[model samples]
Each structure stands twice: as C-alpha cells, then as structure tokens.
Target chain A: DVKVTQSSRYLVKRTGEKVFLECVQDMDHENMFWYRQDPGLGLRLIYFSYDVKMKEKGDIPEGYSVSREKKERFSLILESASTNQTSMYLCASRTGGVETQYFGPGTRLLVL
Target chain B: AQSVTQPDIHITVSEGASLELRCNYSYGATPYLFWYVQSPGQGLQLLLKYFSGDTLVQGIKGFEAEFKRSQSSFNLRKPSVHWSDAAEYFCAVNGGATNKLIFGTGTLLAVQP
Candidate 1:
C-alpha cells in the first residue's frame, strides 16, 4: 500500500505569518499536488509539481507557492497567512500517466 | 474546459439501505472520471475510476459507480449502506489534455442505524 504522510495534522498561525506544510510519499510517484478544501467549494487545487524543482499553478494559487526539492517530498508555502487561508490542506501523489491519486492525511490550518 | 457537478449537498440513508450519489460532468470528449470519499477530517480516498471499456466499475469498500456517456453522468452506488460509509464524496473529471482534475463540490452522506 502507498503511504502519503503530512508534516502537521493541525496548525494555528497569526495573520501575516508564513507557513510551510510538508508532504512525503513513499510510492515514488512522479506528480504531487496541493489543495485547499473549503466548505461548499470542495477541493480546489493550489499547486502541482511534476518533477523536482518544477511546479505549476493550479486554479487557486494566489498567496501560495510550492516546492519539490526531492522526489519524495513536496512542500506548500503560504507567503503571508491570512484569516481567509484557514482551511483543510490536502496533499496527493500519483504516478505519471496514471490518473489515480493517493492522498495524505490532511493538515487543518487555522489563521487568526 | 472540463467540469464536474454533484447535485446533492447532503444525503441521509438508513443502514442496510441502498445508496446512490449523483455526479454529472461537462466535457467535449471522453473524460476520465473518478469518485473519492473523505472521512471526517481526513484526506480523500479513491472510490472508483472510469476511463473506458466497461461503463460500470467496482471500487473499494463495497462502492461502485456507473458511467453513462449519453447523460454525462457517473453516479456512485452501493448495495447496502453501513455507518462507516457516512462521509463526504467528491466527483472529479479530467479531459485528456490538461492532466489536471476538476472537482465538484462534494456530497455529504450520513448513515443512520
């Protein structure tokens, strides 16, 4: 079974703070994704990386960036955390040419 | 552009009852379809996927979904419902080109014993 592990299960930060959420996948997948899930809006993609040091902006990428320094690790960075950025963050990984994504336990972020 | 829609926001069913969650999509050509379930405060898990061949696909945890190209619908169903099945379900679609999935606003399922 593939395992995707997230760095933090829960986090709280004040406004204007910078936050980093980390994700690691054991499956050696080629693609990783970051998403923010909000009530009623569902899971909106934040950023995705196909390979190390390569990233693409998703539908909602404002105020957020990502890094894929290594094949197994992907990080999501919130440049300036705001109250509106408080939401559940999910990380998913998939092998190239395969559409199935394996997701990590989400990180619940609260910005106050 | 590819998009998905899950009409019901919330659904309640009794244990042992049959279940169905509706999903609709808008895409020009053959689209890759997926259904995912998220337990409370957890990440999404793949329930099933449909690319081609058989219209009906079986998934984990006794879940199955059927694809109807004419209606552009890929609805999830289960023969019997269980308390553990209560969760939020999301539908997603990816048109061949982009490699990005478009997700629908999820449907929350509640099972009553």
Candidate 2:
C-alpha cells in the first residue's frame, strides 16, 4: 500500500508567521505535489516536485515555496502566513508514468 | 486548456437508494479521467480512473463509473448507498504532458436516513 503522511493534521499560526507543512511518502514515487483545498473552489495546485531539488509552481504559488531535498519527503513553506493562506493542505505522490496519485491526511492550517 | 466540470454542486439521496454523480470534461485530445472522494477533514482518495479501454470502471466501496467519449462524461454510480458514503466527490483530468490534474468544484453528497 502506498502511504503518504503529513507532519501535522491541524495547525494554528499568527499572521506574518512562517509556516511549514511537511509530507512524506513510502511508495518511492518520483512525483510529489502540494495542494490547497477550499470550499466551492475545490483543490488548487500549489507546487509540485518531479525529482529531488526540482520544483515547479502550480496554479497558486504566491507566498508559498517547496523543498524536495530527498525523494521520500516534500515540504511546503509559507514565507509569510496570512489569513487567506488558511486552508486544508493536501500532499500527494505518484509514479512517473501513472496518473493515479495517493494522498495523505490533510493539514488544516489556520492563520489568525 | 483542459478543464473539468461537475455540474451538480450538492446532492441528497436516501439510504439504500441508487446513486449517480455527473462529471464532464473539455479537452482537445483523449484525456485521463479520475474520480476521487474526500471525507470530512480527510484527504482525497482515489475512487476510480479511466485511462483507456473499459469505459465502465469499478472502484472501492462498491463504486463504479462509466466513461462516454461521445458526451465527454464520466459519471459515478452505486447500486446502493450507505450513510458513510456521504462526502465530497471530485472529478479530475490530466492537464497534459505536465502530468498535473485539473479538478472540478466538487459535489457534496448528503445521505438521508
């Protein structure tokens, strides 16, 4: 079974604070993604990593960055957290050729 | 650009009743289609996928979906519904060579007793 795990399930931070959301996958997949989900808007891609040290921006990448120092771990960083950044963050990993992705339990971030 | 649309925003069905959720996509070429379910406070889970061959694909939890190329639709159906089946369902399509997925707004399902 492919298991993707997030560092935190829920987090609360003050405005302007830097936030880090970590994701790890056990399937040795080459692709990792970060997404922010909102009501009515659904899940929007934030950033994705195809290989170690290689990252690409998705639809909404402002105020957010990513790190892929290792193949099994992908990290999302918020330079300056704002209230609008509060969302349910999801992490997913997939093999290079396959389109099917496995997701981890999301991290619900609250920026007050 | 490829896009996905799930017309029904919200749907309510009685327990043990049949179920169906509609999904439509707009793409230039043959696209990869997928159905995912997200429980409250949980991450999205893959229900089924349609790459090629077998328009009717079966998934976990007694869920099934059919892909119709003529209509550009992939609708999910279940013979019987359970209360636990209530959740947000999303339809997604591969954007292109980038291997990214474009998702619909999602439909919230409410199961009545």
Candidate 3:
C-alpha cells in the first residue's frame, strides 16, 4: 500500500502567526495536492504541485502557498493564520497526472 | 468542464436497512467517477471508481456504485447497512483523463440501532 505521511495530526496557532504543514509520499508521485475541509464546504483545493518548484493555484489559494522541494515532499504554508483558516487540512498525491490519488490522514488546524 | 453534486446532506437508516447515496456529475464526455468515504478523524478512502467498460463496480467494505451515463449519475448502494458504514461520503469527477478531482459537498450517513 502507498503511504503519505503528514507532519502533524493537530496544531494550534495564534492569529497572524505563520504555519507550515508538511507532507511526504513514499511513492514518489508526480502530482500532489493540498486541500482544506470544512463543514458544508466539503474539500476545497488550496494548491497543487506537479514537480519541484512548480505550483498551481486552486479554487481557494489566496492565503496559502505550497513548496515542492523534492519528488517525495510537499509543504503547505500559511503566511498569516486567521480565525477563519481553522479547518482540516488534507494532503494527497498521485503517481501521475491522471491517476487515483492516495491521501494522508488530515491535519486539523485551529487559529485563535 | 466538469462538476459534481451530492444532493443529500445527511441520512439516517436502520442497521439492517438497504442504503443508497446519490451522486450527480456534469461532464460532456465519459468521465472518470469516484466515491470516497471518510471516517471520523480519518483520511478519505476510495470506495469505488468508474472509468470505462462495465458500469457497476464493487469496492471495499461491501460498497458498490453504478454509473448511469444518461442520467449523469453514479449512485452508491449497499445491500445491507452496517453501523461501521457510518461516515461522510464524497462524490468526485475527473474529466478528459486528468486526475484533478472536482469534488461535491459530502453526504453524512448515520446508522441507528
């Protein structure tokens, strides 16, 4: 089975603080994604990366940015956390550009 | 362009009752369809997927989904409901062979005794 490991399962941060969430996939997938899950909103895409140092904006990417330093690692950054940014963060990766994505256990972020 | 819609926000059913979760998609051509289930505090698990060939596909944990091209639907069904089946279900579609899934707002299922 493929594994995607996230750095943290839960986190708490104060308003205006910077936050980083890390994700590493053992399968060396080419496409990786970051999403925020909220009640009634389901899962909204924050950003996605196809290769090292390459990124694309998703539906709701205003306050978030992502970094793909290596083939197996992708990181999501919240430049300045806010109360509304509190939600479940999910990380996923696919072997190729068009394949079933494998997901990691989500990280719940709370910004007070 | 492609999009997904799951009409039922929440549903409650008896343990032995049959189960069905509706999913509708908007895509011109035959699109890749998927259903995922997320248990409490867990990541999303792929229930089933439909790309081509036979429309009916079976998945893990006794879950199954049928693709109806004419109705633009990929509804999930199970013969008997289990308490462990309680989870939030999401429907998704990927168009033109791309893996980026356009997701629908999930439907939460609750099993009663």
- CA lDDT scores, all candidates in order: 0.94, 0.95, 0.92
Tens-place lDDT per residue, model 3, A10-99, is 999999999999999998788999999999988998999888888989889999989998999999999999999999999999877547
Q: What is the CAPRI rating of model 3's predicted complex?
A: medium
Stretches off by above 4 angstroms in model 1 are none
Q: Quote the lDDT for A54 in model 2.
A: 97
DockQ for candidate 1, please give it: 0.78
Cα lDDT tens digits for candidate 1, B21-78: 9999999988899999999988999999999999999999999999999999999999
| lDDT tens per residue, model 3, B56-88 | 999989989999999999999999999999999
Off by over 4 Å in 2: none
Query: How many clashes in each structure?
Result: 0, 0, 0
RMSD of each: 0.9, 0.8, 1.1
> Model 1, range A1-112, lDDT digits (tens) per residue?
9999999999999999999999999998999999999999999999999989999999999999998999999999999999999999999999976479889999999999
Candidate 1, residue A12: the lDDT equals 99
Could you tell which candidate, 1 or 3, scores higher by DockQ?
Answer: 1
TM-score of model 2 relative to the true fold? Answer: 0.98
lDDT of 1: 0.94
